[model samples]
Target: MNKKQILTGFLAVTIFAACQQGTANQDKAKDGKSISAGAKVPAAPDAAILTFEKESYDFGKIKQGEKVHYDFKFRNTGKTPLIISNATATCGCTIPEIPKAPVKPGDEGIIKVVFNSTGKMGIQDKVITVTSNANPEINEVHLKGEVTEP
Candidate 1:
């Protein structure tokens, strides 16, 4: 076949294959059952809810190199158990401890956070983010204070 004829044939085959592939995919999509990106799934009737009595604490002024701690009190107000999956602090100088076991419904819990002023100076604000099986899934607590020279 001449170069022009061969090129035309190749182009025709490529277009035909692409057209077939497109139709096949479209048909499969129409026949298959799948969840849409924005589809709303059935929510839990008895979900875990985390309610905090206090979300922020002020440790006030502390000497540099001193350590201060606070306990953030919370309760599980929902019907299901509250399981904390993770707790993280914005700075390494701050450490947060979560409940190792699940907090049952109507039961109270505490998240203890310790802030070390060793290397931190001046106005300090440490944030702790907690993730759990609670309805909201995520919660935050703050620790504020000032570190002065020792």
Candidate 2:
């Protein structure tokens, strides 16, 4: 094999060996309690989760320069309160408004997305991404429609 390929193979083997050694060390504890080899680590409690009622909205058709909005409803289905760090859109024409307060577990929240069709035409799709402390921390909502000439 070429020198570069040989080097790559050696690097891969070295990384694999290192990872195996790390896993083997996880079976032992300094306090004399031995963890079972097959034991799995438990996940953290009360991770936030977002359950959306609907992820997309279709406005059908609208004239150019018209503005429309939709509220994306969601619930905090996990054990903890949902805190949204930020919500942003794919473009300036689409603005997203997220909740300022934390959504408690089992409580609902809304993410409002307003889309402006100014200077836009044809089939348009706008996306708003929500970032929060929720598990799988990022979620997206979409607004799509046809913008007809005025």
Candidate 1 lDDT tens digits, 1-150: 899999999999999998887655532223365544444444477999999998889899999999998899999999999999999999899999999999999999999998989988899989999998877778998999899999
Looking at candidate 1, the ten consecutive residues that score lowest on lDDT are: 26-35
- lDDT of candidates 1 onward, in order: 0.88, 0.89
User: Could you tell me every candidate's TM-score relative to the true structure?
Assistant: 0.73, 0.71
Candidate 2 stretches greater than 4 Å from native: 1-45
Off by over 4 Å in 1: 1-43
- Give each model's clash number: 0, 0
What would the C-alpha RMSD of candidate 2 be, to one decimal place? 6.6
Cα error, candidate 1, residue 33 (Å): 7.7
- lDDT for each residue of candidate 2 in 57-136, tens digit (9 for 90 to 100): 99999999999989999999999889999999989999998999999999999998889999999999898889988887
